[model samples]
Target: MLVGIPLDQSNNTVKPKECASEMSAYIVEVAETRCKRSFAKVFNYFAPRLRSYALKQMGNEALAMELVQDTMSNVWQKAHLFNAEKGSPSTWIFTIARNIRFDMLRKLQNRKEDVCSDDLWPILCEQTADANEASLDQQVTLEQIGYMFESLPVKQKAVIEAIYIDGKSQQEVADELTIPLGTVKSRTRLALQRLKGMLHDND
Candidate 1:
């Protein structure tokens, strides 16, 4: 079922640029008044592209469709959080879609892991190292890494996230970002070098 109220557009033939402008305006309306017609317009425009994005990530048609639905639901609920000054509507919507896909994958992984069995086996093993100490070290390391990540330039950060966090190949990242493959590689290398330097400093 479509989640937003439908708007009448029987006589309108919106050009691409006009449609983008309209979407931005509609998002603002949705934020200000929870306008269903505006939300519907945004959903109608973005839902198909979002579905294709999900399909590429998970390769499942049903799951992809579900992701699109959930992403739109998020847009409806969190419209107020969107700021046009920070990014475009497409970027905001695609970021939501990416996060939802990540959540779905994480949930699937959690379901596959039998926590009880995992805990039992770990307890049964001979404990040579201190698990608590190791865990604390890992937590600290992750926190430092996150800080380092935030320090990278926007383009470098985006390249690293696409290649590593989002698990996309260099070519895929380049294609998605509309950059050359060589630029993607160079950014990834530079980002990694900086991160490694930060890590080494911590050590």
Candidate 2:
């Protein structure tokens, strides 16, 4: 029988449990005995990558950083429940982040649909913007979009067109771009970032 010493700063005693209790007990002990160091080590290992993932998902740097911090905080609070038999710490942490993001997105009820209809409207239609100014603004918007398109890296431009203009599914864009699905996802995300910047600049 192996006698495990408590190492964590917060809980310097063994936790009683049946199967795989030793590993759980070890983590709990380490955390209780060395709470600061344990949390620091875990944060260092996961924060940067998790922050980048959150930024890609949220499209906002400050919010992304908040999400990452929230994730790490949860990991610290829930560390006692971690089971090596189920998954590694990295996997467990990422799963928590993913769930948090999903919950956040679900709660955001103000989502706007991005798809546009390309069908031409009849000229004998309801009056919208003033004809002359609307025509000028439309021309300016097109010119601005064209300039922004030219500024994008080729891969980013292609992904934007496939999704916004050609109406491709993300999977289809991944296949056509010959990039891994995750790469495709990230590139598309950054492409939207660029577009937002460009549009804001024009405005």
Best by TM-score: 1
Q: 46-121 in candidate 1: lDDT tens per residue?
A: 8877888889998999999999998898788878877778767887787777666765886867765323321333
Those runs of model 1 whose alpha carbons end farther than 4 Å from true positions after fitting are 1-16, 111-203
TM-score of each: 0.49, 0.40
Question: Model 1 — TM-score against the truth?
Answer: 0.49
Instruction: List candidate 2 stretches off by more than 4 Å.
Output: 1-34, 110-203
What count of clashes does model 2 give?
14
Q: Assess the local accuracy of residue 50 in candidate 1 as a C-alpha lDDT between 0 and 100.
A: 85
lDDT per residue (tens digit) for residues 133-187 in model 2: 4333223468778888889999888888898999999899888767888988898
RMSD of each: 22.2, 22.3
